[model samples]
Target: MSALDAKKIAEAEALMGQVDSAPDEYAKAGMYFKAATAYRLAKSSDKSKDCFLKAIDCYENNKSWFHAAKSYEQIILLAKENGTLSEVEEYANRACSLYQQHGSPEAAAAALDKAAKMTESKHPELALEFYKRALAVVLIGDATHQASEFASKVSRILVKLKRYEEASKALKKEISLNLQTKSYGQVGRLVVALVLVQLAYGDLADAKKTFKKWGNRCEHQEVSTLQKLLQAFDDGDQELAAKVLASPFIRHMDVEYALLSKNISMPQCIQNGI
Candidate 1:
């Protein structure tokens, strides 16, 4: 090794040793972190990671959640670069927990959301999981408006994945969330989404029950359209059902819902042979 390389590595070793005799947790953490940076500069990546972990431990010993999370963020970037998916997931989760413990739920949620959007196109299912975690983090605080935003995001992704049952459940919960926040105007739209999801999943009975429970909040046009659509299905009037679903109101609701409506093939009728 060159003289400078040897000197850098020796400095790292000395710094790491100093942490053991440090008088305080913060001092120990600083020493370990300095050793980690030196090791990284010397191209000893594994040793750098080890020193980072020790620094994180010292930070945690002092209840320094933000510093611990910052260290984890370094590990997360390394894991991502190495294509160590499981490690990436683990470190990301730890970082989020630490950020939350530091009373930064928005940061926790934004981190997950950023990861989700980055992966949404190629790894949609994983993206969906990330978004769900983000939603949970957002819910940890008193941001009901933020909750509504994430609820819409989660349900839209669910609809795109054609997970109608999960979409229905998400929409139902969102409706309740909106009602609790006195966002009464949103309830009708969410109820429509829930009922549409139930119908798409061939759970007509649940659709009727949902409409009956929340139909009073719907605008007149929505009420008439949904009533006609449900009746068309019950009567096995496939053409009328298609017409109602293809109308501009349904088509322009949202891109996900538009696609979902297009996939709503003619409902099937079960005839009883008496």
Candidate 2:
């Protein structure tokens, strides 16, 4: 390292020594936090993470939950920058829980949402759990927009995981929230999505039941086309199903239609051994 770098590292080490010898909980927490910043300036990421965590522990011991949450949030950001996704998830969740304990449900939900997004690409199941936590926190705070958004996210993840039943359940929660908020537009979309989930699971009866319950509220052309698609699947008419799947209305449903169309086509592909 250069002379200036060495000098900075030594200064950081000295600050860390003071942290270790601090006489009281508050002072120790402050010192550890300062040392963590010093370690970052010295380009020692591992040491920075360690000192931050030590500060978090001290804050927690002293019932300084807000400070602890901030420390965990910093760790999460550092882990993200370092591309340590597992650490990012861990510290984000910790930050979320601490924010919750500190009586900040909005902050908790935001933290959990960040954790969910971080894990979604690499660990969908874990991401689902984080989204659920976020949903719960937002629901508690009556943050309608966040609650609806997180519920939709959870349903999408569950569907991607091929947990169609759970996906339907999550969609139902989203639908309920939309209904409460009188978000008629979103409710219509979620109803279509629910039907798609049911169809993907081969729950034709439930799909029809769901359609009967909520399809009436949707646009006439869209509802009629989806019904025809469902009917084609029920009749095992591959040509008709294919035609219905290709319709502009179904195409507009995007991923939901893709999932249902794929499921409906799978049996025919297997039978024809193609």
Candidate 3:
């Protein structure tokens, strides 16, 4: 180890000794916290994390909710940097719950949001739960932007999971929020997305009704392309559907197109005669 690292390790050892000899829970927690800082400086991340956890336990024993929450936050950051995803989620959830208990709804929501993003790719169901928790907290705090963004994310994940009904509900909330904010352009796009979800769910009649209700609000090019794509699906013309999907205007609806593709048969034109 470098000289500086050695010095820090020595300082950590001194603090650890002090922790063992501390007269009260508060004193012990402080020493452990200081030792954790020294271990971080010594480039011993595992040791630092352990010390931080010890400090958190001591703080909790003393009923210092805020301090315990802060320690959990620190452990979460450390776990994230180490790419220990399970630990990151565990500590983040703990910290968020503690923050909520402390009446810091914004901090609680932010923590859950971070955990949701971190777990979205590998653990989508868990991420969905976290996003829902975050949305609940954000709604209580009047954070429109976070609420809308998180709801959109939840809808996307639900779509991926083929939970179309839940996805539709989430998208409806997002669209309503967009309307409330007078974000007419985004609301138009979201309405188109809602129709796509309905189609994917095999609610063809409802999809048609939604398109008739909101199609004109979207850009003409987008509306025209989506209509042709929908018609190709309805006609069971996979070749035409593929062609429409290949067009740039409709390519951004990749997820919706994928769902549609699964339900349609190959075009007769592309098949050899029996």
lDDT of 1 by residue, 141-207 (tens): 9778888878888899999999999999888878877887889888887777787888888887898
Clashes of 2: 0
How well is each residue in 12-87 modelled by candidate 2, as lDDT tens digits? 7888778757888878999888888777776778998998989998999999998999998878777777788877
Comparing 2 and 3 on lDDT, the stronger one: 2
**lDDT, each prediction:** 0.81, 0.80, 0.78
TM-score of each: 0.76, 0.86, 0.79
Model 2 clash pairs are none
Q: On residues 189-234, what C-alpha lDDT tens digit does candidate 3 reach at each position? A: 6766776677666566676776777677678776886688678766
Best by lDDT: 1
Better of 1 and 2 by TM-score: 2
The stretch of ten residues in a row with the least summed lDDT in candidate 3 is: 265-274
Q: For every candidate structure, what is the RMSD over all alpha carbons to the true structure, in angstroms? A: 4.4, 3.4, 4.3
Better model by TM-score: candidate 1 vs candidate 3: 3
Q: Work out candidate 2's RMSD over C-alphas.
A: 3.4
lDDT of 1 at 168: 90
